[model samples]
Target: QQPVQSPQAVILREGEDAVINCSSSKALYSVHWYRQKHGEAPVFLMILLKGGEQKGHEKISASFNEKKQQSSLYLTASQLSYSGTYFCGTEMAGSARQLTFGSGTQLTVLP
Candidate 1:
């Protein structure tokens, strides 16, 4: 099943911080985070594995809790360039490894 993200949209000023959450009903093996600007394809942000292994930039951090089957994206010191639509893709355990993305969270950073 596709994961569900909270706070479908958020507006932040430069240097602000925000948190986006993704929760799935099924067991998750990995959670992938991507950001897509308007008129552009989604760009990979990070991936969190079931064992708490993380691969991504330091500016963007995420956590995956196997027990809760949930993940959260932490956007720190937000910048205007950060404005975009964020999506969380989920890979369920015992599945084909196909990623099912959440609806999306629109983040707008104002100067």
Candidate 2:
């Protein structure tokens, strides 16, 4: 099943912070985060495995909760370049390389 993302849209100022959540009703093997800008393909951000490891790059980070079958993406000290649509893709157990993506969460960072 496709995961559900909360706060469909977010408007933030530079240096602010925001969180985007994704949850699935069924069990998930992994969760992937992607960002897509207008007229560009989605770019992979990071992935969290069932072990519930928290992964981060720069000011962006994500955490996975295996028990809750949920994941959250955190944007810290947001920058104007952070504006984009964020998508969470879920992979089910036994499903290799296949992912079910959520509708997406639009994030806008203003100066």
* lDDT top scorer: 2
How would you encode candidate 1's per-residue C-alpha lDDT over 30-78 as one tens digit per residue?
9999999999999999889898664547667888888888899999999
- Number of the predicted model whose TM-score against the real structure is largest: 2
Q: Write the per-residue lDDT of candidate 2 for residues 1-111, one digit (tens) a residue.
A: 789998899999999999999999989999999999999999999999999999999999999999999999999999999999999999998887799999999999999
Reference-based TM-score, model 2: 0.98
State TM-scores per candidate.
0.94, 0.98
Q: What C-alpha lDDT, on a 0 to 100 scale, does residue 74 get in candidate 2?
A: 97
- CA lDDT of 8 in candidate 1? 99
Q: lDDT values of the candidates?
A: 0.90, 0.96
Name the lDDT value of residue 94 in candidate 1.
88
Worst 10 residues of 2 by lDDT: 90-99
